[model samples]
Target: MLFILAAIVLTAHAASYGVDIAESISTSSIKCLRDLGFNSFFIFRAWRSLGSFDPNAKSINENALAAGFSAKHIDAYFYPCFSCGDPAGQVKSFWNQVTSKKLKFERLWFDIEGTWSSSKSSNRKFFESLTNEAAAIGIKSGIYASYYNWEDIVGLDYKFSRAGSWPIWYPHYDGKKTFSDFKSFGGWTSPYMKQYNGDMTACSHDVDYNYRP
Candidate 1:
């Protein structure tokens, strides 16, 4: 009986998985992840400041709260489309919206994959500025990108080592499902989050599976 009880307790405290969604997913899809035992979510908010914000962010947040799941916000404004106007302008616009709306997330993720910003120096400056803005508002920030993108955008050199200090969320779908499969890369000894699979399903809706360590 004691052994059986221990098994039950261990199962109750097992680590939970989560998913990342965007405008492509409806508010109703939030339930899909919850039903799959996901305890957290990261919903895409915007591609750029000038681009449209996700119309379903609030609904997803509300639904996640109702389902007893934590929901966070994500944005792809780091290297926005070149045609989206000035990068600095978009950063300011994004920061303004983030402050004015009172998005109650403890942390935010900045997507760092795009061809608009070519120079390494420009990209590094943009990242520093984004981190500063988030710090001013008392919100922690993380970088979300694949290992390839990390090496390509920031490199593994001493100068780019600054990125490893921040929280790293690496996405790699290499058919290795275990968290142990995610090894350190690009100067980061350990990643905060690892997107191990991109073909996960919940309630018939497709979502990416992420492991939070």
Candidate 2:
């Protein structure tokens, strides 16, 4: 039937598309993002390095809730910026924010970078603790890192263990390329998401475009 064929066509076109934004990107709004071809969003809930929370996350969560966005349509994550005064305490603070504000997300991602880790052992330990904390709270977690960051900070021979099992949202950008160009980074093979464009202008707002495959 023509109706059944049309349903299949729309189903194939319903692949997930998302964008990641932080408080620093002041122009970004949930309404504009959704209107500009993005069906899902990954908003920063907290930044550990600053030893504080991002107030924007709460607003975005509220906006998404009011807009009737489902959990499958949004993701909230915490970013632990470089070597802070207390890594363990930073993780705890992020946990507290989620509970107090009642934020909900299907998955969390750890923003890993080269400048964050002091040494391989310390870097490994940070992820180990983050993984444990995520497990306790009943949330799936992943790593957001480029291959260069993983090798530069964590060492090429480093064994990630529990954290290694976490999905990777690889960032290997080459402007205006197909998602098939997304390559494996660090120790992860077959990344869960590909950030294809970092400096993309969508709805007149700068956003990092991502594809969920």
Candidate 3:
């Protein structure tokens, strides 16, 4: 029992414990994880791009609250398409959804992949405006991308290039780069450099790591 307790403690700090995932997540699983001391979770396919939107966010929060999670215990966000629309439309849509949602959340995550930002000036303008939009309504926002992606697709040193808004630290196990420890991953691709991502549906008993970018 003592060993088990120690192991749990050790694993808890390694990453955000969005470890194991299931086909469909249940309240019991979420509750059990919270009881185990996990305060964060990643929601899989938590979007409504096409058909009707799922009430998963609110429902999950409901269950989590029943299990003992306050608003402080949960953080939720989604995968956003950087090139979804023109700059203005993108910012409008992002905040529109956030403002519409009544669900209690801590942060908004924007995943920038496969899209090209026009220029540093344009990127900074849009990003800063987006951050200001979220903050104006009392919400926190973040961006997910690796250093390589930033340098290649998106230019670094934008006005909003700081780590808090756009943390660049990534996960690498090949021993080539030794900055970030492996953490929660959102997709199936291995070697993710994120502290927490929504890879699966259910929580797990495994360990996860967290770090700054």
TM-scores, all candidates, are 0.75, 0.81, 0.56
Q: After superposition, how far is residue 59 of candidate 1 from its true place, in Å?
A: 2.8
Residue by residue across 175-210, what tens digits does model 2's lDDT show? 543456654545565677778788777666567888
lDDT of all predictions: 0.59, 0.68, 0.47
Best by TM-score: 2
- Output the lDDT of residue 174, model 2: 73
lDDT, candidate 3, 64-174, per-residue tens:
556665666454544444445344455455456545775665555544445557675555565555555555655565555555555554454332433444333243334
Say what the RMSD of model 2 is.
Answer: 3.4
2 or 3: which has the higher lDDT? 2
Candidate 2 stretches with Cα past 4 Å from truth are 1-14, 24-28, 163-165, 176-179, 182-186
TM-score of 1: 0.75
**How far out, in Å, is residue 109 in model 1?**
0.6
Judge candidate 3 at residue 121 and give its lDDT. 58
Deviation (Å) of 158 in candidate 3 = 3.7
Q: How far is 206's C-alpha from truth in model 1 (Å)?
A: 3.3
Q: List the residue pairs that clash in candidate 2.
A: 82-116
Error of 3 at 46 (Å): 5.3
